[model samples]
Target chain A: MPQEASPHIVRSYEGELRRLREMIARMGGLAERQVADSAQALIRRDTDLAAEVVRRDAELDQMEREVEQFCVRLLALRQPMAADLRLIIAAMKISSDLERIGDYARNGAKRAIVVAQQSLISSLNGFERMSELVQENLRSAIDALVEEDAEKADEVWRSDEPIDGIYNGIFRELLTFMMEDPRNITAATHLLFIAKNMERIGDHATNIAERVHFVVRGEQVTADRPKGDDSASAVAGAPR
Target chain B: MPQEASPHIVRSYEGELRRLREMIARMGGLAERQVADSAQALIRRDTDLAAEVVRRDAELDQMEREVEQFCVRLLALRQPMAADLRLIIAAMKISSDLERIGDYARNGAKRAIVVAQQSLISSLNGFERMSELVQENLRSAIDALVEEDAEKADEVWRSDEPIDGIYNGIFRELLTFMMEDPRNITAATHLLFIAKNMERIGDHATNIAERVHFVVRGEQVTADRPKGDDSASAVAGAPR
Candidate 1:
């Protein structure tokens, strides 16, 4: 009799895990769209679309909160071990990153709204290309996660380096525009925020890839891209 | 026969959990010192010091990996329940945030190195103050986490608003400097990066606060003031 009851509890635990997976996928899809729309609004200078992007970020945040709550509750109640516990925790971390990505998109969209109104906004200079890359990277990272595909995750991680180069190019171009004339400052600042948002989206994509690696092999793959040095002590003697 | 050994396994699992706690505390201390040093580097423009900061970042990243691995191993072996599972997951997340915070400091110090060559580059307003606030918030948030104090976590959350405001102020100032003169672009770019890094540190601190709330109360807390609601429709539109 006791054995039967314990198995029933385990089965219910499995049910909760399934539900959690569904919630994460839902959140991922919405987050991906927010990035796409935010980019489209910027290129098109459609304030209405940008405003919409801003509004949707709140729901992403709320959904993320809900999913995290569900996962933690399941862990507390069921006491999943090994792969199951890892799955729930990975979901929590992944959702948090996605929510932040949504926030970035909304922030970019807000800037797009302001820049769209200006009379002298400069050319975005391959920004649309960069935005598309970011969107694709994000979409694929989530796909890799759900499928537990390590190759796809690695691809997503590699995608971030190129995205960073593009961001640097964009940054320099914007700096030049602002230097050329004062009228460019406002729109340029907004554009810069959008670019930063795109770069951050890339970062989140990398985070998802790392999570995918963790889920698949039960080992951390973040060690692949090694940071150069500590650079911690360099702060004290530098000019403030 | 089995009854005699059950208590031993339980006891060993508890010991492993305690060890995790100690590791988390050590990681927290390392991260807090990084923040402090980054601020000092910003104030001093010390290139050597900045280099050290960058060096320390890798160590923190390594520590993060180790912490994550330990958490995984524990989860796999112990199948802990309720508060114990919550604690482990929180530790995993908190260490990730700590590593990222270390990154922010390294990035900041790198910028300080670039700015070190320039003559007295601190003209950008609000950065020094933002740095101090971020550093203080990080210290307090880590303290709260180590001590398991919810009220401290709340204070960290509330403090993020002011940090955001200061970051905005720094952004605007840097934009003005770049707008005013073409020659300042390179150095100002470094300064802008420094500002972004500080803002990121603030974000990391907020993340810790959220984890603390999740660990202690099994509920989610808003890490910052809520933005626009339009994010709702956007979030709702995605396929679940």
Candidate 2:
């Protein structure tokens, strides 16, 4: 009887691992939607959508807690080794990165509400493009996790430079607006932060991809992460 | 003979736990110094020190990886149960938070270098005070982890409000400067991000405290975290 039950136990453990991946995939889906809606709220100046995005962030926080608790329980009960162990650890870390992505989205939504009240500073086309890239990366990263595809994860990791490139352009353009007219300062400043938030969200997506790569390949991505955001060291001349 | 060997094995495991705590404490000390030196660089307009801070951040990233590797080894070797497991997990989580804190400090340092090249906008007294409080909180949180004092962690958790309050003040003041003259926009904007970095560092400290609290008590902090950053929704009128 004990011998017969052993097979069932092994199968159930495998099922639990599958369930864990599903949970993360679900959480990732919600986070991606939050990012999309927050960006939409900004581009369309929809305060209601922004407000909804803010209110919805609590769900991501709660999902993170659930993921953490589930991972801890698995660690305790299964004492999983090798790949299983790495996958569980990766799940915990990925949940954290996703939670932070949700936070950046929520912050952007709040700033959007403020930006909507001011006159348009310039075309928000850059913001739209930036967010679209971020969401695509976020989606691809999560898909790589669920599919256990390290190549896809590496693609997401390598693709973040373009998002940073867009952010730099937005940063310089906003600074030009501020210098062109003081009236643009308030809106431009808030928009700068929102753009920063999107760039950060992209970074988190890259972090998730790196973790997935580690889980599948049992090694860190050896290449230095490419970064294009030079805004930190940027200096603008005074308005003449 | 087997019993005799078992005693030695248990003692060695105990030593490893002690070593883990020491590792985290040392990492925390380094992170605190980075925060302090970054703020000092900003306040004194010391470009060399700011460059040094930027250079030193790689060490924190390496430390976080070491902590994670150690925890994974322990999990695989000892299969630590209950409190031991919790402590190891908390160390992993706290190291990630500390790594993030180090990144914020490094980014602030980079911006400080740029700010140093520009004319002074306003007194950096607020930046000094904010960094001091953040360092204090960071130190207390690490101490709480080492001493297993949940009350100390709780105290650090409650004290983040003041840091946020300082950040909000700096945000408005920077906006006012940008409106007064476009010449101040570049300096003021960098200073604003530096202040925001300090606030974020403080939040990471609080996150560390919360993790420590959970390790000690085996439950989440149930109270809603107090937040004072209203700058997210702030709006400033055109300059007179």
Candidate 3:
């Protein structure tokens, strides 16, 4: 009779896996909203919105912890093998990456509050553009992972180059602004950091995409990732 | 006879676990050297040393891959339960943290190569002091993990506040320097980034210590980890 009652108990395992996936998707959505809101707060100089972004980061952090515990429980209770194990592991890694992206967005929001007080810079639009691109990549990466669409993940990976390009432009422009006038240094430095933070968010997106690829393909994505951050070289004026 | 095998065969399982521990220790050593060497290169303006640090990052990257694969194989083959399961998971997480530490060091070294060309600032010594503290913490954290010393890991976690204090000092000092003179902006900006990088390295050390605590104690470390980087509020000039 116990063996015959297996169908009812077996459904719970599938339900647990589905619940884990849904939790990750919820986290991704929160992180993406934080990214978009923080950028808007920066561009609009809305200190209130920026403060809200800072407060929302804790939710993602909490979600990441919950996801980690869930994965561990599944591994211990179900003893997942092969593809199932890989899926659980990838979910854990992806949650961490999403949590980090939320942190970056919070950092940007914090910086935005600072820069808002200063006389606004004309070139601040770059932050908006950069954040928008990274947000798109992050959303796509999560979608790819959830759908198991490695091709879409690959697309997200390829789109990172443009984000780097925007970042490099912002870096050079900020450096030039700082060099031209002493007054620009403080705000320019903050802007540079905000730009750098967005770039890092892009990197995290690529990292998530790679995890998706690994889970689906059972192989590492080995292409040399492109980076366009040549600001140091430009600042040093060193010949490569 | 096969079931009642000699002690030699039984020891192999323990040996595999030891090998994994040794691999992590080796990776930690390499990351420590990278952190120390990169900081020295930055402070001393040693281009050759900075270049060397940059080159050595690839080794840590390779080690992370090896450690990951080894952990995956262990999980699949041994099907470790409870404590052993937690240790393997912790090992995977710790290796990734170490690899990120290696990246931060490499970024610092790369910036150092550029900053070397500019006039040196006396306040830059703060970075040296900060890097030393993080290196010590990282070493202790790895030692804790390898030896399963939860007490030592707690010590490392507690040590992070002082590291943050040093970082905050560096941050405020750099800001004042930049505000005082335009000439200080370029080098000060670079120094600010290096200091931030080291601060992040310290945070990663705390993260490792937390993981070690988890593996040994079977419970998450619940203390409010300290942070002293108040640059954002100072820059924002917001009333607390």
Candidate that would win on lDDT: 2
TM-score of 3: 0.95
In terms of lDDT, the poorest run of 10 residues in model 3 chain A is A231-240
User: Candidate 3 chain B: worst 10 consecutive residues by lDDT?
Assistant: B231-240
Question: Lowest-scoring 10 consecutive residues by lDDT in candidate 2 chain A?
Answer: A231-240
Best by DockQ: 2
Two-way lDDT contest, 2 vs 3, winner: 2
Q: Which ten residues in a row have the lowest lDDT in candidate 1 chain B?
A: B228-237
Ranking by lDDT: 2, 3, 1
What's the C-alpha lDDT at position B209 in model 2? 96
Off by over 4 Å in 1: A1-16, A226-240, B1-14, B121-125, B222-240
Residue-level lDDT of model 1, residues A79-158, one tens digit each, is 67777777887898899889989988988887787777766556675688888888888888778777778789888877
DockQ of each: 0.24, 0.82, 0.51
Cα miss at B147, model 3 (Å)? 1.7
TM-score of each: 0.85, 0.97, 0.95
iRMS values for every prediction? 9.1, 0.7, 2.3
> Residue B139's C-alpha lDDT in candidate 2?
100
